[model samples]
Target: MTTVVSTGSYDYLTSALTTMPTPVTTSSTWPQVPRWLTLRQSLRMARDPVGNLNKVLAAYGDTVHLYLGGVKPSIVTRDPALVQHILQKNHRRYHKSDLTHGLLRYLGKGLLTNEGADWLRQRRLIQPGFHRQRLAGLTRLMRAAADEWVAELAALGAAQGPVEVEAHAAMTRVAFRIVARSVFGDSLSDEELMQLSDWLTAIQLFYVTTIRQPYLRPVQHLRGRYRQHDDLARRLRELVRAAIARHRTAQAAAPADAAPPDDLLQMLLDARYEDTGEPMTEHQLIDELNILLVAGHETSANALAWAFFLLARHPEVQDRLAEEINRELPNGQEVEFAGLPRLSYALQVVQEAMRLYPPAWIIDRVATEDDEFQGVAIPKGSVFSLYVYGVHHHAGLWPDAEAFRPERFAADAQPALPTYGYLPFGGGPRLCVGSHFALTELQLVLIQTLRRYRVLPTAETPPGMNPLVTLRPAGELRLRFEQR
Candidate 1:
């Protein structure tokens, strides 16, 4: 028999649990619970996300039965205590759920999907690549790229032409390029870089579309998009193989006394595995590169697109940010590493935007062992999804929740807010390692872009949101840009 146990954080779970009259029935021999209409709600989540999920939270409470193919589903919990319990105290008892596992055909054994010692080892090997000291040097490169993008936008805005900002496409291409240069240095050609990027985008979109199809709910292997996906995957594998070969040749040709290239690829080549006294295998290296390409690029691009959409809607906020950028860049030159720290308000605006539209919007996990919280039991294998959007939008958790108010994050005010309440990079040990790099990238782009042009939202062309993998503006982002 299944039993419900309550970890006392009554007030925190109130928003999610208040609606339930009696604790839910859960047991080994209990009759199967009827499928609730709420199960269908997960489908509509990508459409009207925050609003719909809020409804579920308000209706079902903290822990409730959501019959997904006859099994219970656990949704959101505002209880920071329970969140702590799940993410830290007993993380071993939980692993990334199938939704993330299903993402593996595209993402490979990227840190986002893996667990246990392998995840630990991979994370350790890759962590130094994102260190602040190492990343500080990349800021100049990032700023230069941001300036080029700004100049293009400025010219379009000056023409006053209808600009369709294929935000996804544009950002995807640029982000892939950034990671390529930053991670691999000059080992990869622009031509090879673009080819790899095109295939990555195609595969990502294909995987996004195919995974959610309803009919494939039963026959996972017979999914229609697999063949096409395989074609793209095969192309990407070939491209990566070529790049690895080129990198080896470059290393071999270098002078015996020459220093290593100061790029992430070189860094990876130099990295050692304590157990084996050897570097990562070419296949493992490709998988890690695959991880960086997708996890690094898509997430940042989506976050930037969402940030721009928010800025477009709030012209006043954009202007405030523009003023900050202008003050920092009064010389009318492209922003440099020295100028980034001065753009504090611009940074806050981006931070608040992430709070409103986080790219990795939802995170899911499955219980490996039975667990309980506040008189509710989470059976082994039960799927749990943290509705980050729902938690961010919860009225009680965030005052004036829907409003885009960057002031809430003013320097002095930031430390006062609850830590987990605004988790754009997530919480616990699994918090994003690239967060420092992503934030630096966004800050550079925001400062450089806003300094050069005002991105005015088109009344006729509303931002299209497609919650495929990340929450992105669909149809590219079409904006009326006006040069500053």
Candidate 2:
């Protein structure tokens, strides 16, 4: 069993995990599995990634070299030390893999897909926008969105019959609305939000298909698959451009003494490169906005969907959560941004859900130069697939790895996990900029949700995993909401 230790705070818990020694030798070759085996594994991975990864890791140990249907060999690892080595210690020697590079057409060189100096520059300029202080200012906006969702759920419950709602779809709307309002204020219309969400979903599906099935590339090209996605991408870009244009128009019409609203778009528009003193170009801003919209909403929605699904299965835990919310936040009491720290159990539930189903289930990095980890030779240009799901579920690190247990993250019961053992938002310098923002949004939504309703499993409980651009539930997660 994993050992639990008292930690200072969630920030410290995340940033101060156990550290591992850096590798110093580059002479040993990694254990190589046959190409045929990898080919078979890839097929299984297409259908059931978590199962395939679990099997591969169990058989091959921490690291295994396998050819991934391309010229280069891929290194798949579930070892926390190796993960820390690649993602933290010698991170300068690696860049995001070609898989992420493929996303350039859709995401551009924004923070998510950018590399090297540009990435550093963007990270520095945009980091402050997501700082806890700035995020606190947006809690009202987030709570408003969550309130709307709860009200809608209550209405659904009031209808005579038991109401079954798709958890993913419901959470998607809430997450998107919170992100949209936080980023662009009320500039985007409902029609535009719907269009952006639809187009983004389509684009992600196309990207995943093209990346996973390289054999389909030729057929996709012949059928103008690129054109189809490109049209969708263009339309999304136009939506962002329209929002930006509206911001500018509104700014131009405002009185000189009036202050602009403090929001993500305003922050991005006002940010400047520290070295060059140059602001992001209009096109660049659009790319950044698109990245934010896609990243902000999609991953959080997946996590929240899974959280509710887990809660539905474990009504005891759900009841405990509702009890905590009721005891902490009485009737007519609003959960402010500052009050989030009090919702510890609610946060723990979300954290545990993410441990089971991290949206970014696998993170890829390409070696920028020859390197080594524990004598394993890592040649330059090799692709490393850090199996996050494998690590989070590793039997050695997490006892009862497959079980749903929120106490694993409880204040006094939190375990001392390895540095990279639980990377729902990744690790090291490239850690997600929106980690705090995402966590806060999730906690608020859960607080509002449980306060008004008890999430119960429907016939379709515990949805299967659909590993795609983000790890999503296989189908609509149907769950019944019992109003308090």
Model 1: how far is 21 from its true place, Å? Answer: 9.7
Residue 382 alpha-carbon offset, candidate 1, angstroms? 1.4
Poorest 10 consecutive residues by lDDT, candidate 1: 1-10
**lDDT by residue for model 2 over 1-484, one digit each (tens)?**
1211222233432242223222222347656767777776676767886787676656656677777652348888887778888888899999998788887898677899998988898899899999887898888899999999988876775345457888899999999999988999878888888888888888988998887788889999999999989888888888899999998898889899997776899899999998889999999888888888888998999999999889989999999998889888887599988888888899889899999999889999999999987766788998899998888887667768899999888756645554577888888889888888999999999888888777788875467888887889997789888776
Model 2's C-alpha root-mean-square deviation from the true structure amounts to 4.7
**How many clashes does each candidate structure show, in the order listed?**
21, 0
Candidate 1 lDDT score at position 305: 79
> Among these predicted structures, which one has the highest lDDT?
2
Q: How would you encode candidate 1's per-residue C-alpha lDDT over 216-311 as one tens digit per residue?
A: 634545655677677787678778778878888999999999987667777788888777878888878887888787788988888887787788
- TM per candidate: 0.86, 0.92
- Residue-level lDDT for 410 in candidate 1: 73
User: Relative to the true structure, how large is the alpha-carbon lDDT of every model?
Assistant: 0.69, 0.82
